[model samples]
Target: MKVEQNADLPKTTHCNKSRRNLTEEEKEARRIRRVLANRESARQTIRRRQ
Candidate 1:
């Protein structure tokens, strides 16, 4: 019999679905995090263009 390798496995997640069930505060925190991340990305783009 030959042996099988499962070294590379894909992850199955339901985190995004569960996140939708979070409270308002948690959703707001995520929004804030995304806003901050976007702001930093914009700053980097401006610096690169300069």
Candidate 2:
């Protein structure tokens, strides 16, 4: 009637580090640029609405 609990946590890992989000400086810069562009576009949209 008693159920045994899982003692070991399931391993969730990628075999290669490349599979993870290991962005370099250039990639990080690109991400920031995209975020800034999105924010600017949103502001422009709000201005057009008003």
Candidate 3:
């Protein structure tokens, strides 16, 4: 009986880039949404403790 070993492999490189820009309004909206999400999570934690 005989066994063969395989331990050689090649790595690949990726080069991805973004191609879209956000306007000022869009940026503000994203910031507000994130703040609201965090606030909601904190409220949930306080409710659990009560």
> What is every candidate's alpha-carbon RMSD to the true fold?
14.0, 16.7, 18.3
Q: Give the Cα error of residue 12 in candidate 3, in Å.
A: 25
| Cα TM-score of candidate 1 | 0.61
Clashing pairs in 2: none
Name the 10 consecutive residues with the lowest summed lDDT in model 1. 1-10
What is candidate 1's lDDT per residue for 1-50, written digit by digit as tens? 22123212212354555444657896676666666666666777898999
Best by lDDT: 1
TM for every model, in the order presented, reads 0.61, 0.52, 0.56
Best TM-score goes to which candidate?
A: 1
Model 1: lDDT equals 0.55
Q: Show where candidate 2 strays beyond 4 Å.
A: 1-23
lDDT of 2 by residue, 1-50 (tens): 22122212223354565565544985666666666666666777898999
lDDT of 2 at 41: 69
Candidate 2 is scored at a TM of 0.52
Can you give the lDDT of residue 9 in candidate 1? 29
* Candidate 1 wrong stretches, greater than 4 Å: 1-20
lDDT of each: 0.55, 0.55, 0.52
